[model samples]
Target: MDAVPGRKAPMASGSAPDLMYCQPCAEDGNKILPDAFCPVCKEFLCSTCARVHRNQKITKSHALQDKTSMPSSFCAESEDEKFSVTCQHHSKEFIKYYCPRHDALLCGDCVIENENHRSCMVEKILQVAKRYQEGEEYISLKTGLGQMVRDIENYILYIQVRMKSVDEENLTNINEFRKFRNEINQYLDKRENELLAEIDQTKRTSKTFLNELKTKYTNIKSATEKLQSDLHAHEANSNQLLIVGKRAIKELEDLQTALEKVSMSKDVSRYTFDRDPATERLLASETAIGRLKEGESTTTLGQQQQKQEKKQQEQRKQQESKQQQHKPTQAPSHKVNFQSSVDLSQSQFSRQPDIPMKTSGDTRNCFLSSVACLSGNRILLADYNNQSVKLILRPTWCCPRLLCQVDHGTCVNCPVTGQPSL
Candidate 1:
């Protein structure tokens, strides 16, 4: 039987009018009592319509329940009183099917509207939901998420540790730099003070020496004035005049000698401050200060005096040697008695006799440059004329035997230079 428009459908005898009717049959204008409810379609179905729904390939997989056992809300008369959940795309349809290919739930309208599902495998959304709860893909996804979280946490920890270490290293470097700077500052300060002290001392010493010279020159001037006054006063007396004249001449000579002895050599007293060359180069790229050194053009006065004395001694020796070479040689007249021990302080002789030794080779024209006494009563003589050094063993003063002779060139005439002890 077909349903009439705007008319109440006649129910079976003794059946309630509020009982749900088959939705498919009602669309065809037939009023049929419902035997089953299709959850997928969200509609009541008659026994005949339910058999047709199951026979179709598209609706065969949809789940259905007995109408009498269906929920009262699902079988409500008003469309708004049906299931609460609805499809996102089709607002009026409920979500029933799941498309595995799209990984989304779909309504009956969506399945028909989208052509992508024509060849895609789709199942009930409830069945897909149940399988996902126990599937390996879901479990693996959760596991992978957990692993990512752990990895991120480890990276964070590593970064924190590295940052802490870097901070500590930076602080350590800063402290070291501070200490190094302080040390350099202190050293420079101390060196500056020392250099200043040296300069002050040099100035004071120079001034003191100048003052002494000044005082000595002033005394000399006063004495010269006195002599001039005496010469003028004694001009009338011949005896006093001769005496004053002689005294003035002597004073003038003494003044001349003093002036001759005084030397003003600027090369001997020049001073300067300089930085160490190596330290100066090092300062080009570093923070450290270069060291300062006080330099002088010449040695100290005492050192200069020592050197002068040594040169004078050498000159005196050369002069004595020349004098000895000019003297005539004579044979010994007496044989001296040899003593086991002699007191040097009491030892005295008017004339010491030279012991003559016989030599094998010609010695008359031989110019001996140097002589040295060796161990075991040996003597080394360097003969400049023959250009040879002769080593002699003198067992007795009268009988000196030549042990060996070495020939050399200009070295024979040069001063004997000392060598390291063997």
Candidate 2:
């Protein structure tokens, strides 16, 4: 019963009542079985309550039902039904009016007391509330409440799973970061050993070249000293010693020329060992190995959810359309004479099809192979030459439209925009 006023939403679908007890007993939070039925009050009363009710001054004249005559059980009414026959504000008066805009049940005293109730459109509660629970709106309300509860639960689970995934991803990233750092350390250590070996090689090559030059110069100096001592041992007037001295001097000049040539050809000049600026800059920055990129997983998950929701919406639309197509329509209240409504004797011509049926695929003139009549005076025509179907409007309506074209040999399949394929 839609007697609830100032309610947030409709009640959910409930199970059938199985517990049988006195109405008065249940109302007073008790569970005693009913012994008698009060027809005037529409209440199931227990033995003690029936005795008290029968002795009451107001209900003494009313007839009570026999214990055997009462129904096997009484279904418990809602709290709204308890206050349905009377108003809470006006306890002494019966409910007389209902405000449609506010969805409020009111008594005559309430209508007279409130200024807004006097101006607004009011209806008799008996007229509006008749078969209220059986109406479509009420049924949909009950269904919507159940669906909303399920959606909320599913959404809560989705949130919890997403939060857990994010935590796991964070741990995975931390481990990845540590692994990457270890690899970098190993690479730098390898490069450092190579650089040290290269420096040692350069030192050994330069020192060896210098030592060979020193030994060649020392042998030349020793040979020139021995020749000078032998020449001094001869007399000052000896011609042989003078001639030998001259020859030795020429040889010494040739040796000096050879030393200059060797120094110019294979001497160690200079070298530079500068650090790589890119590597230095990278080490100085906060994110040396790699920067953390975030939100990709969350964004992908949201996109997937959106796609799922879109797919579900499409399925619902398809289902609803199928239901509408299969739904049984009510027959006309009055008889419809089909022969009188449509006169087949009359001949009608439409020039609309002449223009569209002459496509490139039509090798011959258009031929109406078959024709079918649809509701609302619409006609469906099949063209044999063009292999196409057209929806021709009635004389009352405007024009004919090409609905679909099948692929006959090389012909393209053209269907109307926003129309489903057959």
**Which candidate comes out best when scored by TM-score?**
2
Query: Model 1 off-target regions past 4 Å?
Result: 1-129, 263-268, 275-422
Model 2 per-residue lDDT tens digits across residues 1-422: 34322112333579543444566567557778778888766667889988988997766766888688976554444544544466788777778678987888888788889988888898866445543645677889999999998878877888899899889988999999999989999999999999999988988888888888888778767876877786787657579778877887887787778767666666775567889999999979998799887654554445778988999999999998778756664443232232321112333433442334355666777888765546775777788877788776655322222122221212211122212212
Give residue 187's error in model 1 in angstroms.
Answer: 1.8
Ten residues in sequence with the least summed lDDT for candidate 1: 413-422
Instruction: Give the whole-model CA lDDT for all candidates, comma-separated.
Output: 0.65, 0.66
Error of 1 at 256 (Å): 2.0
Instruction: List where candidate 2 sits over 4 angstroms from the true fold.
Output: 1-98, 104-114, 121-142, 235-244, 277-281, 284-287, 294-306, 309-422
Model 2 worst lDDT window (10 residues)? 406-415
**Model 1 clash tally?**
3
Put down candidate 1 lDDT per residue, 1-118, tens digits, no spaces: 1232223555578876554567768767887877888786677787998999899876788788885676543422332343358998889887778898888788888889999997
TM-score of each: 0.41, 0.45
